[model samples]
Target: MASRRAAGRIVRGLGYTSAAAAVGGGVLYLSYRPRDIPGSEAAAVPPPTYGEGGIFRPPSFPNVKTRAEQIADLKRSSGTVSGAVEKAQSGITSLLKGDANDVQESNQGGKDEPYDLLVIGGGATGTGIALDAATRGLRVAMVDRDDFASGTSSKSTKLVHGGVRYLEKAVFELDYNQYKLVKEALRERRYFLDTAPHLSSWLPIMIPVDKWWKAPYFWAGTKAYDFLAGSENIESSYFLTKSKALDAFPMLKKSGLVGALVYYDGAHNDSRMNVSLAMTAALYGATIVNHVEITGLEKDADGRLI
Candidate 1:
């Protein structure tokens, strides 16, 4: 009888608790419930409507300026600050139009003045030189047999690596020069990614370790690569388990597979990068033209080619 009384008390306690909780919840709901203000009925906003393409189109306001008009007003207010914008727009227009005659006329010097430098080719090397010269305030003229980057520059593998093979040779042959070259290449790789972030990005490459013993070798090599890259390293090298490797690359040979080592490098759109360099050079006061060839050279009495 005493145990039954204890159980009855427990059931009563639970019932009281449940009643309290339900009452609290109902009170909260009523307190936070949305309600119309006394005078806001007339000022109620209409529901948002979807326009074509399923986009939410807000209601238009009166006297809203279009984008072009807004820009014009801004230019008027900013005064001379808009000159830079106009110049950049003109440069873009010139680049798009590819007016060789305009470029030639703009770059022509007086009878006594001569071009500081004349680049014979508009390939990667020549365009890079032109850009450097132009940025340094030199009068530069660049001519190409064909369009910029239309030759070997466009036929690249699109990889910007630090020469892992060179690193390996450096290790095996104890060649300090090869190691230095790798270090410099790695730094250049970082520069390429940083300078043109839109055109270049980090690429993850997997080196399969077919032998169990080769895992340590490849891992050490990749770590060394990262170390050589130093602060310029994009990401650290890592190892992947056999199962993960096979999952990532299904075409791998399963026999004697011992996982893989992955390392980071860089890749870029080579042709686009070259063209951008050329255009940037042109913008920096370098005269660049295409579809011209140099057949022969004549030397003056001073041993200078004319």
Candidate 2:
């Protein structure tokens, strides 16, 4: 009975001790608790604690001025920049739009009428001129007995290049138009290759030189041709031994041939090139018609050839 009484007392003691410890912890918490303020608020309200002090405010600009105030401040501080923003916007638009009528539609009325440009011969020269005029915001019409490049242009040496023979002749020799044409042709060649790579590509040519002096001279001129190009699309000019040259081109006469200068230029089936260029021009807002003839040169009231 006595042992049972002792066990009961021990259980009661443990319960009392636990209750006392809990009450003591509660008292400590109450002692250090935040005291209620009598409405003494901070004038500089600390911003709410955002994560890591980085906040995502919804772009609400406070102390934001009205349009009048902003304008007055701008006039006072920076002043007007003339047409700064307008000019900038125009420049950006021009750059982005890529030429004035880049995205414009063509006047198909030329096809409805007799013609716009009466390209007499449908050779490269005429077709080229027609394409140039037509793409540059003019109406164009072409006529031939058959398809384009069916004349002298069709039978040329078939190179869209700086005529190397003329270059050699010009020891005091170079035509300004020819040089300009070479440079322009190189750029145009790039455009053609870019726009229609399958049809237009760089081609290597073999120029047979009979003498050592002629070989170096020919090589130099071709190098200059390649140099004039902003970028070389084909392999640079190199000397080929008689055997190598003959292997490449067996049709040349074996007599008087010392070595040959093999260089690159652009070549094409001129007829196909014309068709492709015409299609590209049409895509870029040029109206083109083939095989249609004009009875007479139409003139405006001012006597300007219409």
Candidate 3:
């Protein structure tokens, strides 16, 4: 797999958002026709919140700021970020233990130490968090109730594809935020194949086009999907003849098959990847522990998590 250059491109600036989904089979990357919504047709809605429901919330201090706002704030506070990792390292220390509640208070680096990050759950999301923080030189610790990737992470279909359905919805609803999400996912899909080649492989998926006319239609969609991926794309998509499609998969019924759209995605061992992330984090000085269920949380006087 070729490494994609980090040629900075400005995708649609939305609110700060992170999405996770169970890896699945090839998405139906059908081309979507963007619909233009008139200015009068837009709905009048309040800003969204980051936390659960809260009534009588103030407009100035919004519970959740959009991605645009978050980026803007980062730019404004750019000077304050120097030595951030060092500070986090000083604040947090060895926080991992077999028992979730077992905090070695007498130890030099114990529960009393100020942690930079406390990642709950040991699935892909949690381990990814721990790895990212540890790599940044932050004091990070992760705890999972059970074994890592024992949940949906291990149960994934294991194909890493851009969410074509989300793209379809974005185009239909004229939601630029959704468009940004699709672009992000596509980029990450490429990253997985590029970084962890040992654990991941390219999977050629065939979209059987039952009707002759539909071949061009589906092919166009996949082309757009490939284009969105840009340098991250694994390989260019191409059409296969009916006989060629049947040859690729002998189980297909030959009667109505007109052609197929063949595209490249990624397949991997989801559980192993999750474990690898945790191990990598541990190697980077993060404390990773499992079978530690967090029954409750502790907070300080300021209502901040301890």
Q: In candidate 2, what are the lDDT values of residues 177-271, reduced to their tens digit? A: 66666667677776765665556556777789888789768778877776777564545666777776788789878898887886777776777
Model 3 lDDT tens row, 1-306: 123332222121221121112111132222122323222333334356555556554444212233344234322321212345554443344333232111222111332344556788999999998877765556555778899999999999997778766777787899999999999988888788768877877677779999988987878777887788898875667777788788889999999989889777778899999999987776555567777787887676666665
Predictions in order: lDDT: 0.72, 0.57, 0.66
- Model 1 TM-score relative to the real fold: 0.64
Residue-level error in angstroms, candidate 1, position 30:
55
Candidate number with the higher TM-score (2 or 3): 3
Clashing pairs in 2: 170-173
Q: Give the TM-score of each candidate.
A: 0.64, 0.55, 0.63
CA shift of 98, model 1, Å? 27
C-alpha lDDT of residue 72 in model 2: 39
TM-score of 2: 0.55
Q: Order the candidates by TM-score, highest first — what do you get?
A: 1, 3, 2
Ranking by lDDT: 1, 3, 2
